[model samples]
Target chain A: TQLLEQSPQFLSIQEGENLTVYCNSSSVFSSLQWYRQEPGEGPVLLVTVVTGGEVKKLKRLTFQFGDARKDSSLHITAAQPGDTGLYLCALGGNEKLTFGTGTRLTIIP
Target chain B: DVKVTQSSRYLVKRTGEKVFLECVQDMDHENMFWYRQDPGLGLRLIYFSYDVKMKEKGDIPEGYSVSREKKERFSLILESASTNQTSMYLCASWGQNNYGYTFGSGTRLTVV
Candidate 1:
């Protein structure tokens, strides 16, 4: 089975600061997705990157799939308190999606 | 916007009691899933359905069962609830080719 590893299991930063979190795996992937989950809610999809070296931006957040397809990163510019949540990266499989352990982010205002 | 709705936002049940958690999706998705969320474990899949009356086991399906009687509703059943089974349950529906799944808010179930 393949496993996904995310760096800095927990993160805290002052509002307006920039932050970046990473997701990695030893196995190559065809696609990867990022999601954000808040308290008392299920995870919501943020972005999906299919091509190696591809990058997609949503407002102040930027997501990139590694050139080797073994890693990905999410960068948040001018982070706000609303940006705080658990971030997860998932890989789709035969009939299900495998998820990473997740990175909990806290943006202090 | 597409929506996946879970029956309850919170629930409390006694150990050994049979519990049923319902999930419905409005997007007419063919795939529906049940997952349990924990503090460190992230979201662990419990069960899923490909279509009505079609069910399959997931990563963790020991004490749980699922039902997909209709095309839009999928229900997760706990044959015998236990303290260890207490967790936030999430329901999701997916469209083919698009990996961005639509998920319900989640039902927080506590077994005492």
Candidate 2:
């Protein structure tokens, strides 16, 4: 089974601060997706990176797929209160997805 | 926008009862998936179907069964509800082009 591990399981930061979360795995993936979930709701996909060393930006959030396709990262620039939610990284291979433990982020005002 | 709808947002069931969770997607997606979300375990795939009447077991398929008789609908059946089955259940659907999946609001099941 392919396992994805996320760093800083819980993050608390002030508004306007920049924060980065890491997702690492030993096995390579064909593609990777990032999702943000609000409380009591299912996750919403933020971005998907299919190429190694690919970077995608969605407004204030940036996602990067590692060169080896075995890791990824999400960075939030000038986070706001609305950015407070659970961030999850999922690795895809053979049409199946392996999700990370998730990072619960809180952007305090 | 693609829409995924779950039958219930919250459900309470007793142990040994037969439970059924229904999910529907309006996007005409070819792939549908069922997963359970726990506090620390993240999302564990229970079952997925690529086409009508075609099913495959996911990472955690024990104690759960799924039926996909139509392209737009999928159902999850719990033969005998147990306390360990109490968790948030999520349904998702995606197309064959490897696009991002659209998820439902999820159903929170509580077994006593």
The TM-score, computed over Cα atoms with residue i paired to residue i, of candidate 1 is 0.97
Q: Which pairs clash in the backbone of model 1?
A: none
Per-candidate TM-score, first chain only?
0.97, 0.96
DockQ winner among the candidates? 1
The sequence of per-residue lDDT tens digits that candidate 2 reaches over residues A1-109 is 7889998999999999999999998888889899999998989989889999999999999999999999999999999999999999988853568889899999999
lDDT of 2 by residue, B3-99 (tens): 9999999999999999999999998888999999999999999999999999999988999999999999999999999999999999999887646
Interface CA RMSD, all predictions: 1.4, 1.5
The TM-scores of all predictions, comma-separated, are 0.97, 0.97
* DockQ of model 2, rounded to 2 decimals: 0.70
Measured on C-alpha atoms, candidate 1 has an lDDT of: 0.93
